[model samples]
Target: MAEKPAWLKPHGRPWTRGPGRVVFENPWIEVTEFDAVAPTGRPAHYGLVGFKNHAIAVLPIHDDGCVTLVGQNRLPFADYSWEIPEGGGPLAVDPLDGARRELAEETGLEADHWREVLQAQLSNSVTDELAFGFIATGLRQAAGGHQMDATEDLAIARPPFREALRAALDGHLKDVLTLAMLLRAYHMAREGALPAALARAMLG
Candidate 1:
């Protein structure tokens, strides 16, 4: 088991007074306090926000050693670019299901094998979202086809690992979460710790 860090402790009771947000809106995790004192004896809040959301990302490596990616227009970025298929939020069950669903919905591919690689809380001090990074292998093309939201226009692409990494580093691929997962996957593949197909994908 992983050891807990020294700063770990059960959350103290919320400091806010009375019930909030329940009467007028959907139920959400409320963060009463986001600022904290660090070892440097300085205060940092990292621009605290009230809630955390959960999301997932999929890196599909094919038999021919090419990583599956998507090029799409992002309203935030205001451009067409490359990124791994990812999304899921406010679900009723474990987020892994959402991860799998997003992969199939966005990329038209299914994996016979999937593993949870990491659980990351983005902007931990503020926001209330946990992003789960998953490693998927043994990919097979889907028959039912992709089911992306109409507003989300996506074109699938298969790029060799080096090329993909280069694109990521060069700003062609702009999603921070996708870049993080791919580089971590690359390191795992390099160490012979990832699926054989993933390794092959990186090489070819």
Candidate 2:
């Protein structure tokens, strides 16, 4: 059985949500305002952002340990963002399948091996955006080419895994999904969970 820290346990009282009304909604997200009771026994109003699809991220690591990344301009942040391949999976679909499609779409790559490395609740306080991150090894170019959205303008990069991880740690690559996936992949490499040769390539 897997072990967990003794100190690990849920803390504090749970918030009780009462009636809620949808404040805004679109194909991608819905905002709802709710009547709620805080953990501290206080009544409060809470606003929640609900996502209609699961977020999926893929770290496509080549045999040489180069991690494929995609760059695009983001309107919300008003900046160019470089990140691993990411996309939304329908709630009813397997997230790993979504990750594979995203990898092919954004980077025109596919993998012979896939491992689910991370699961995250993007923002528990405000959003219920669940994300799944994967490490895709044994990479190769997809013969079908990419299938990006018509509106997407993306730049691709093949950077050493260590360098990409460093940029994420140094705050240069600001995508949270990319950062989280890279950190998890690093841990996997160091902990011997990954193939030794591949791990060596990643770490060195």
Candidate 3:
């Protein structure tokens, strides 16, 4: 585990975990049931979900301020979700390399510029699923079209950046990584981190 940054002061007492037993195991995730002592000194039973890969998300923004969106049916929630291109890469691999692969495989797009915008712990309460989000610009079509997974049936679209951001705010798109990346881009544009004309196109 990585150490916490030295700048911040420590707070309350931390929870101490005890012996654990595996309740479930799979290629993607593992659930371990453990006995722990909470910060309040109370005994608690907890189930920790561990992931085998890091989630990599890519927001492919075109020079014209258009963004690539992929829609697919998510079985867990039994709903169709529209999101930026995302997939999993092994924990031992570089996230940027994973992001590049995900972008090409899902949208058949290559980006000349890549900026990592966000790192988050998704559902940290029970799971340690960490995610990395990137902004990919200067986009162009890949030599071959998308090579979707055998089980994937993605619906692809290119909507203006503003419209996509609006969809996320309106609850039409609720993927965590997608929401964070879009808002990050908006902040970047407002702060002049992006080119003026490109920012204008996105803000429009």
Candidate 4:
């Protein structure tokens, strides 16, 4: 018997509803309108909806191999959640520039080295958004507090490599992006593909 190619398999649920973007304010993305048809063949109208947009996130590795985490206030949950340093605001910031800025703003550390790690798409039934993730190692302490905005009063934590991974597994680090990068960084560091500090932290 012949097996199908991995790509041939459906990766997501079949769209039962068809919602088309009715109006577009921005070319990259826009408020969308959807016509969701029911299983019984009845069609329904879905009005305006806020669309998702591209974003960049960083899992910063310090000189000692620890991953830097920021505790910040998230209005959605009305409480602070531990996530990777992230934010290009509501708009797209230059990829590298935004990654750099986020590293500094959230962690008060400047990276001497960085590289793009992964590019992923978040697909919902209605919309999909691209997210860029980066691996930042070789961190240097900043002279002043991280430049934080009103939504980002954060405190930085540098946890040991294994400790961080354990935290992530234990739900202390529940941020999806952070978990993705940590596992990626872990493999890279284990193979000595990462900078010395990162490798050391991963082994610890």
TM-score, predicted candidate 1 vs. hidden true structure: 0.75
Each prediction's TM-score versus the true structure: 0.75, 0.96, 0.94, 0.74
Residues 56-134, candidate 4: write the lDDT tens digits: 8998876676778888767756866877887653444567888887777777888778889878765554455567889
Considering only N, C-alpha and C atoms within 3 Å, which residue pairs clash in candidate 3? none
Count of residue pairs whose backbone atoms collide, per candidate: 6, 0, 0, 1
Model 3 — TM-score against the truth? 0.94
Candidate 4 error regions (>4 Å): 1-30, 36-53, 89-93, 142-145
Give the lowest summed-lDDT range of ten residues in model 3. 1-10
Give the per-residue lDDT of model 2 (tens digit) for 89-178: 999999989999999999999899999988899989899999999999999889998989998999999999999999999999999999
RMSD of each: 4.9, 1.2, 2.6, 5.0
Runs in model 3 lying further than 4 Å from the true structure = 1-8
Cα shift from native, residue 198, model 1 (Å)? 3.9
lDDT of each residue in 50-101, candidate 3, tens digit only: 9999999999989889999999999999999999999999999999999999
Most accurate candidate by TM-score: 2
For model 1, the local distance difference test gives 0.73
- Regions of model 2 farther than 4 Å from truth: 1-4
The TM-score ranking, best first, is: 2, 3, 1, 4
lDDT of 1 by residue, 1-204 (tens): 589997896664433323333212224454353355555556644333444347778777766667888888778657776888888655456777877788889988889888877677776655557788887778887787798887788888888778888888887777877888878877888889876765866765
